[model samples]
Target chain A: MNAAYVNVSTPHADRNISGIRLAHNRLKVAVFVFLLAFLVTAARTVELGVRSGAVEQSLALDIVVEPVQYGRADILDRNGEILATSLPSTLLQADRFKVQDPVVAARQLVEILPHLSYEKIHSQLVGKKGYVELARQLTPNQKWAINALGNPAFEFLEDEERIYPHGRLASHVLGFVDVDGKGRRGIEGFLDYRLSQTDQTQDAIRLSLDIRVQYALTYELRAAMNAFQAKGAAGLVMDVNTGEVLAMVSLPDFDPAEIKSTVEGARFNRAAQGVYELGSTFKTFTLANALDQGTIDLTDSFDATKPLRVGRFSIRDDHPKNRILTVPEIYTYSSNIGSAQIALEIGKERQQEFLGSLGLLERPSIELTAVGVPQLPPTWGKAATMTVAYGHGIAVSPLQLSTGIAAMVNGGRLVPATLIHNSEGWQEGKRVIKPSTSRKIRQLMRMVVTKGTGRYANAVGYRVGGKTGTANISVVGGYDRKAKISSFVGVFPMDDPQYVVFALLDQPKGTKKTFGFSGGGWVAAPVVKSVIARTAPLLGVAPKKEDASLYETVSLMIEE
Target chain B: MRRMVTGLAVITAMASGAAVLQLKLAVQDKTDNVRKIVQDIQVDERAIRLLEAELAYQTSPNRLQEQSNRFLALMAPKASQVLADPSSIPERPAGARVDSSIDLTVALEPEVKKPTKKRLYKRKGAQL
Candidate 1:
C-alpha cells in the first residue's frame, strides 16, 4: 500500500511541475510583448518631439517664402494722399525651346499687346533658347489675353511699375522712374536711396506738399498761362515759418508716365532749376538788408529823379517815380532808380555778402536734384552792384527768391526750404536780419499791396502783402524789350505772415484784358490773389473783419 | 507586492505617454492654425494697401475738381464764409422756427475779448 501511494504522489508532483513551467513560459512571452510595445511607443514619442519639429519648421519656411519682389516704397503727401506708388505688373517672357511655333506665339503676343512691336517680339523669341522677356509692364487685360492663349512657351514674371495717378499736376515734384526702375529726376532722384530700399514692410515717404493747395495753384497758374498766352509758368506755395513747400508747379509740365513723348522743355523745373533775373522782388532783400545794417531807414529818400547812371549801365524804373522817393515809396512803386541808389549806398562787397547770407550765391539747398546754381556777375563792380540791386546782373532761381523773401518776413530767420513733411509748425534757422527790420519790411510789403503795384494781389478778408517783379528776358547781347518774366511773391494774413505764394510767367504776352501791359501786377498778382482766396480757407485760415487800427497804422506810415 | 508595483509603473508610463502624444498633436494643430492666420493677415494687408491706393486715386484732387465741375453745385468755402467763433455767426431770421429739443446757447457762448492797446488815430467817416 505505501509503494502504490508513493507512485501516485510522484506522478502528481511531476504533472504539477510541468504545468508551472508552461505557465512561466507564457508569462515570459507576455512580458516580452509588453516591453516591445513600450519601446516602440517611446521611440515614436521621441520622433514626434525631435524629428517632426524639424520637418514642420522646414514646411513653415517653405510656406512663408514669397517670390514677388516689390521695387520702391510709396510717396505720400502731408495729408497721407498717394503721390507716387509702385503697382505689381506682369512681365511676359518666352522660352524658345518650349515654343511650338515662334510665329504663332509672337502673333498672339502682339494681338494682346498692341503697343509692342511685333518685329521686336519675334526677334526676341525666334532664336532665344533661354528665357527672354517679350514684353514688360503688361496691363491686366494683356496678361489675361496672354493667359488665354495657354502657350507653354510663355511664362509670366512678377514685376513692379511705378505709377503717378494725378498726372502732370505734381509732375515736377513726383518725377518718373526709368525702365530699369531707377529714379531719374525730381524727388524720385533726390531720394532714390531711401525710396529704393526694397523693404516690403515700410512706411511711405511723406512730402511737405498739400495736394489741394497744389491743385489750386496749378489750376490758377495754367488758366492764367492760357489766358495770357505765356510760353511757360511756375508757381510755388510755402510755409513762411517752417520753410515747407506746400505746392510747386512748373508748366508746361509733362505727364510723369509718358516722359518719352514729352519735350525736354516740359521736363525743366522752372520754379527750381532755371535761374532768372527776378527784378523788383530783389528790392525787398536790399531794403531789408540796408535796414538790418542800419545803413538806411524808412524815412531815408533816394534820388530817382533820373535814370541812375553807374558807368555804362542806366537803372531806370519800369514805373518811374521821377522824384526823390522815400524807401517805402521806392519799394511800393518798385522804383529801380531809387533801388540802385540805395544799393550804391550798400556797396558791392556788402551786397555780395548780404545776398550770400541769404543763400542766393550758391546752389539752392533743397531736396530736388535739378537745383540751379546762382549766376553771379564776373566782377562785382559798381555797375554790377547797381544793376543787381534792381535784379539784373545776378540770376537766381524763383525758389531761392522765395526763400530769401520768406526769411525777410518770417521774423528775420533764414529757414532752409524743405520738401519733407516733418509735421512741426516752425523750424529753427539761422538769423539773417533783425526782428525790427522784419517788421518794417512787412509794413513795406503791405504798403505795396495797399497803395502800390501789388494792389490786385490783395484777396478779400486776407491781408495779402507782396512785391511785383517784372524783369525783361535777357537776349544774346542785351535784354528783350518785349518778352519779360513777370512774377509776384505774396504773403497772406500779413499781420502774422504764414505762407509765401509766388507766381511767375515767362514771356507772357500782353493780353487784351491786361490793357497791353505784361507786368507782374497784371499777370502774376491776380494768380497769387486767386490762389490765396481759394487756398486760405482750405488751409484753415479764418477770415476776420478788417482791423481798423492796423489799416490806420499802415496808412499813417504811408502818409509819413 | 513587487508584481503589483511593476504593473502600476507600466500603467503610469503608458498613461503619461498617451498624454504627451495628445499634447504634441494639439501643439502641431495650433501651430498650423497660427500659420494660416498669419498668411490670411498678410493677404488682408495687401488687399487693404491696394484698396487705399485705389481710393486715393479716385479721390485725387484733380479728379475731384473735374467731378465737382461736372456734377456738383458745391464750391470750396470762401474766406468770408468761415467764422472763428460760433458766437460770431449771424443770428437766424426772426420768422424761422427754432428747434425746441436742442439747447444751442451752451455751444454758442460768447468768448471774452482780450484787451488791446489803443493807438492815437483820427476817425474817418464810415471807416472799417
Candidate 2:
C-alpha cells in the first residue's frame, strides 16, 4: 500500500487533484442537504399527521349530506279542475366503471330500451371519467330489464316527475319540461322554479285552465274553421270578474308534450301572438265609448242614408239595407257611419285614452312570453280616431283585445288575466269605465246580435250579444280589397253579460251560403254563435231567459 | 399489571376521544348540509310556484276566447238554464262597439253602374 502509484510532481495530478476534491466536497454537501430536507419533512409530517391526529379527525366530521322528504301540492282549474300534477318516479343510472364489458352492457341496455342508441351508449361507457352513466328514463319494464343484469353498479335516484295526463289537450298552455326536468313554456314556464323546487321534499304546480272548456273551444273553432275554409283562426273566452282566461285557442297549435316538433302552423299561439282588424267587433267599443262619454244617447238617431265621407275615403256597410238609423238601430244594423259619427263625438283624445286604458295600445303581457306587439295609430288625429273607432287603424294581440272587451262590457272593471289558480291572495282592481256604460254597451251588443251583423252569433237562451267586423286587408302597398279579415266579438247571456268570446278568420274564402262574400257576418259570425251555444253549458252558465227586456230593446230597435 | 391496565385504559380513552371528535364533525357537517338543503328547497319551492302560475297563465281560458268568432264546442244554454249571474262573463268596452254603421250602398254604388257600361262598349277606341 505504501508503494502505490504516486504522482508527486505531474501537471495532471497537480491540476486534477483540486477538481477531484471540489467534486467530492460538492457530493458531501448534496448528501447533507438531502438528509436535512428528509428529516425536516418527516418531522413536519409527524407533527401534523400522526402525532396530532388533526386532519384524520377533521375528515370524519365534515357535514354536507342531502336528506329526502315527502308530500306534494294540489292543482285545480279556474273552476277547480286538476290540469297537471306530480307523482313518484324512479330514475336509473349505471356505474360504468364497475361494468365488466361496457359494450356487452350497452347491448343489454338496448334490449331493454329500443329507443336508446347502442353505439352512443357504448362510446360513453368506454370513454367516461365519471363512474355513473344515465341509461335512460325507465318504465317499470325497463327497470326490470336492468335488474336482470344483476349489476351492483345500477342505482336509482328516487324522484318525482310532473305529469299531464291529458295528452295533446291544451298542450301549449300547460307546456312541458326537459329531461333534466325544467319547464319550458306555458303555465309551467311561469311557475318553473316553484314547481321544480323541493322544500324538505316535493311540491306541485296548480293551474286555472278547465280542460273541458278548452276542448269545447278548440273543437268548435276547428269545426267553424273547416266549415268556413279559413286560412287561419283564433278564439278566446274570459271570466269578467276575475279576469280569468277560460278558453283560448290558435289554429295549428302545437302539442306541449312534443314541444320540440315544428308541426304545421302549431307553433303559433294565435290568441296571444296574432293581431288583426276585428271588423264589426270594433263597433262594440264605439257604441260603448259613445254612451260612456255621453256623446250619444241610446235613442239618438243618426242619418245613415249616405256613406260618410272623410279625406278620400267613403265608409260602407256590408249589409246595404240603407235607411235613417236610430242609435239602437245603428247598433242593431252595424252601421259603420253611425260608429264613425259616435267616435267623432267622443273626440280623438278621449278615444285614444279609452283604447289605451283598454290595454289595446301596447303588446299584451299576462305571464306568458308569447305575445304580439300592437300596431296603433302613431298620430291620434281625427282620421285615426274615426278609423280606430272601427278597429281599422290599430291592431292588437287577441289577448289584449279580449282583456279589453272583458273589462268593457263586464261593468267597466279591468281585471288582470291570470292562469294560476290563485291560492287565496290579494286580488287586483282596475276600473276602466262606468257600470251604466257597460250596461248600455251590453244592450247595444244584444241589438247587434238580434238584428245586425252579429245575428249569426245569437245563442238561443244564452242571450248571446255581439258585433261583426269586415275589413279590407291593409298590406305593405296599401289595402288589398280581395283579402278580407272578418271577425266577431260576442257576449253570452247578454241579459247579464257573463263572458266575452272573440273569433277571427284570416282570409277566409267565400262560401256559397255567404253569397261569395267573406264578411264578418257571413264568415265569422256563425263560428261565434256555435261556440257560445256549445261552451255556455260547460262554463257552468245555465242559460235562461233572464232579461225579456234585452230582447225587447233589440226587437223594437230592429222594427223601426 | 396495574401499569399495563392503566396504559390500556389511556389508549382506549384516546381512541374513544378520536371517535367522539369524528362524530362531532359529522354532526356539524349534517347541520350545514341541512341548512343548504333548506336553501335549495326554498329555491325549488319558488320554481314550483312560478311553474304553477305560468302553466295556468298559458292555459287561461280568456286567452282562448280572445279572438273574434273564436270557435268553441260549447252549446248555448237552454232557456231553462241561464245562470243567475250574467256579469260573470268578462266584457270590455274600450276597443269594442256593438253598432258599427256602414253604408254598403256607397262602396257598391261606384262599381254597380260602371262595370256594365264598360262591358257594353269594348270598341277599339270608344270615346266618351
Candidate 3:
C-alpha cells in the first residue's frame, strides 16, 4: 500500500513541475518579440526624421506644373477708356471621319451661321480630308447654338480677336491689326512686342491722348475743311510744358476698324508726314533768333521803301508799310523785307544753329513711324538764308513746326513729344532759348492775335497769341499761285502759356465769307478759335475775366 | 511559444500595412478634389473676362453718341452755355414758383389696391 501511494504522488508532482516550466518559457518568448518590435519602430522613426525634408521637397516639385498663357494686353487712354482690347472667340471645325452625314451637318451649320456658305462646308466635310475649318470668330451665342446640335463630328477651337472701341475717333494713333493678330500700323505696329507679351499681370498701356479734346479738334478741323473747300487738313493740340500731345487729327482719317475701306489719301497722316514750306510762320523764328543773339533790338528799324532784290529773286511784303519800320512794326505788318533784313543781320551760321537747336533740322522725334524729314537746303547761301527767313526755301512737317514753337513758348525748353502717358510728372527738358527771349516771343505772338493778321483768332477771354502762315504750294518748277497751304499756330493766355494749337488747310479755296481771301487768318485761325472754345472747358483751363492782367503782361510796344 | 511570437509579429505588420494603405488613398482623394476646384475657378475667370469685354463693347462712346442723337434729340452745349464758375450761374427768377400741388405719392400708388376691412369701412364712411 505504501509503494502504490508513492508512485501516484511522484507522477503528479513531476507533471506539475513540467507545466510550470512551459509557462515560464512562453513569457520569455513574448518579451523577446516585443523588444524586437520596439527596436525596429525606434530605428524607423529616426530614419524618417533624417529624410523628411528631402521627401517634402520632392513632393512639392512633383505637384506644381507650368502656368497657362493668356494672349495680349490692352491699350487704354489717359482717362482709362478702352482704346484697344482683345476678346475671346471660337472657331468651328469638323472631323469628317466622325461625321454621319456631311449634308445634314452643313445645312445645320449654315442655319446657325448665316455668313458661312453651305456648299463650301459640304465639300470640305465630304472630301478626303479628316479635318476642316467651318467658321472662325464665332460668337458665344453661336457656339452655344452649335453645341446644342449634339454633333459628335464638330469641334471648337478657342482664339482671341482684337477690337478698337472708339471707331474713327483715334484711328491714326491707335492703328489697326492684321487677321493673324499682328500689328500693322501706328502705335499698334510701334509697340507690338510689348502688347503681345504672355504675362497678363501687367497693366494696360496708357496713351497721353484725351478723347474729349481729340473729338473737339477733329470736329472743328472737319468743319473748317468743308467750309473752305480744302483738299485736306491737319490739326494738333500739345501741352507746351510737357510736350504731351492732347490731340492729333489728320483729316481724311480712316476708320481703323475697316482698314481695307480706307482711301489712298486718307491713310496719309498729314500732321506728322506731309512736309510743306510753311510761310510767314518762320518769321517768328527769325525774329526770336535775332533777339536771342542780340543782333537786332525791338527799336531797330529796317528800310522797306521798296522790294528788296537778292541775287535772282525779289523779296516783297504782302501788305507793304513802304517806310522804315521798327522790329515790332515789321512783325505786326508781316513784312518780308524786314524779316530778310533781320535774317541778314543774324547771318547764315546763327540761323542754322538756332533752327538746329529747336530740332527743326532733323526728323521729328515723335512716337510715330510716319515722321517726315525736313527739306533742308544743301547750301546755306545768302539767297537760301533770305528765302528760309520768310519760310520759302526750307520745308518742314507741321509736327516739327508745332514742336519748335512749343519750345520757343514754354520757357525755352525743348521737350520731346510722346504718346505714352508720363505718370511721374513733367519731364526735364533741354533749354533751347533764353527765358527772356521766350517771354518776348510770347508778346509778339499776342500782338499778332490782338492787332495783326491773326486778329480773328482772338478767343474772347483766352488771350490768344499766334502767327498766320500762307505759303503757295510749290510745283515741279515753281510755286503754284492758286494752291496754297494755309496754317496758323496759336498760344493762349500768353503770359503763362499752357497749350499750343496748330492747324493747317491744304489748298483752301477763296470763299465769299472773307471777300475771297483764303489766307491763314481766314481759313485756319478760325479753326483754332473754334477748337479752343470747344476744348478749353473740357481740359479744365479756366477762361480769364474780360480785363485780366494777362492782357497787360503780353502787350507789345509798337510805333504806330 | 515560438508559434505565438510569430503570430503576433505577422498581425502587427498586416495591421500597420492596412492603415498606411488607407491613409495613402485618403491623400489621393483630397488632391483630386483640390484639382477639380482649381479647374472650376479657371472656368469662372474665363467667363468673367468674356462678360467684361461684352460690356465694354456695348457702352462704347460712339454708340452712346449715336443713341443720344437719335432718341434724346439733344444738342451740343455752346461755350456761352458753359459757365466756368458755379457762382456765375444765374439765380432762379422770383416769378418762377414751386408747384406744391404735385402729389408724387398719389401717382406712385397701385391702381388695384386690395382694400382691408378698415380701409373699406373708411371709404364707406367717406361716401356716406
A465-548 per-residue lDDT for model 1 (tens digits): 999999998888889999999999999888889999999999998878889998999999999999998899888777776665
Clashes of 2: 101
Candidate with the greatest DockQ versus the true structure: 1
TM-score of each: 0.83, 0.67, 0.76
Q: Lowest-lDDT window of 10 residues in candidate 1 chain A?
A: A60-69
Instruction: List the DockQ of the predictions in order.
Output: 0.29, 0.12, 0.15
Report the C-alpha lDDT of model 2 over A165-254, residue by residue, as the tens digit.
555666667667766667666766666666555671243445556676677677667766787787777877777667767777788676
Give the better candidate number (1 or 2) by DockQ: 1
At residue A193, candidate 1 shows an lDDT of 85
TM-score of chain A of 1: 0.88
Q: Considering every candidate listed, which one attains the maximal TM-score?
A: 1
Top candidate when judged by lDDT against the true structure: 1
For residue A303, model 3's alpha carbon misses the true position, in angstroms, by 3.1
In CAPRI terms, model 2 is classed as incorrect
Clashes of each: 0, 101, 0
lDDT of each: 0.85, 0.71, 0.82
